[model samples]
Target: MSQFAENVSKRLCSLDVFRGMTMFLLIAEAAGFHEHFSTVTEGTVFSGIALQLHHHPWNGLRFWDLIQPFFMFIVGVAMPFSLRKRLAAGNQKKVTLHILRRCALLFCFGGLIALCL
Candidate 1:
């Protein structure tokens, strides 16, 4: 493998793990694990954890509310390493432009999907 690729891979292990755990939590939320726990273990410590696992009803924040921000933070943490790796691999200006455009597209698509939801 390329040196740049190797360097990025080595540098990003922790970031990748963080990102994966955030995604897993998001998926668990989607699967209604929190709701299930709340129903099954009401008034118990597990239920308390279940409550924290869900988003606040309104005008407040919960641990679940941090999932998106945590995901974004992970992305932000990796961006510099990724860009440096690409540059070190001798990618051209056009390739950098393409990467920027793709990032914009992803942001737009995410916003659109959120709106639809």
Candidate 2:
């Protein structure tokens, strides 16, 4: 494999591909040009797939609902890689401090967004 491909594989694997595919299907096909895939997709697929991915009326799980979880998982996965790089570069102090700061910031941001909603 090429150096770039090898480096990326060391970072994340096919799970990232799945996330990208999910995002592409939701954004490109569902939100934008769904008509293009209508003829090619089977009856059970892509037919209101976007709508179904969203949460149910009151409460329940759904494939579309997992998108947020997948994104949060990627961020969690990134923390170790990012912290390791900082430590390797002699920034262990900064890395240690930033982890908590980032967590707090993310929590606050999420809270604010939820409040607005």
Candidate 3:
């Protein structure tokens, strides 16, 4: 392997797939796909799958319930790889500044969104 290839670690494709799947499911939920889909698929063979898309009632776990935790897991797994990549490309100070800037922007945007809602 080349020096650069050795320096930069391989990305986890499975994690990317999970992240994409989670985002797609979230977007579908936001667009009201799940409600319509469940209604349309009711009493059919796909009803069970459609129901799995919805959250479980209190005191139970469901596929939808895992989405948030899986998203967090993906982030947790990716962060160290991201930091390592940045550090390999530059120095600790630059990576730390980048992380700080990202956090600040995310917080500001989150607050703005909350205000809008």
Best candidate (score: TM-score): 3
lDDT (Cα, tens digit) per residue for candidate 3, span 1-117? 688888884878888888899999999999999999999999999998898899767657778999989878998999988888899999999888999999999999999999999
The candidate maximizing lDDT is 3
Q: What residue pairs are clashing in model 1?
A: none
Worst 10 residues of 3 by lDDT: 54-63
RMSD (Å) per prediction: 4.2, 4.7, 3.5
Candidate 1 TM-score over all chains jointly: 0.75
The total number of steric clashes, by the backbone 3 Å criterion, in model 3 comes to 0
Q: After superposition, how far is residue 69 of candidate 1 from its true place, in Å?
A: 0.9
Deviation of model 1 at 27, angstroms: 1.0
TM-score sort, best first: 3, 1, 2
Of the pair 2 and 3, which is ahead by TM-score?
3
Once superposed on the true structure, which residue ranges of model 1 sit more than 4 Å away at CA? 1-9, 107-117
Q: Estimate each model's TM-score.
A: 0.75, 0.57, 0.77
Better of 1 and 3 by TM-score: 3
Candidate closer to the true structure by TM-score (higher is better), 1 or 2: 1
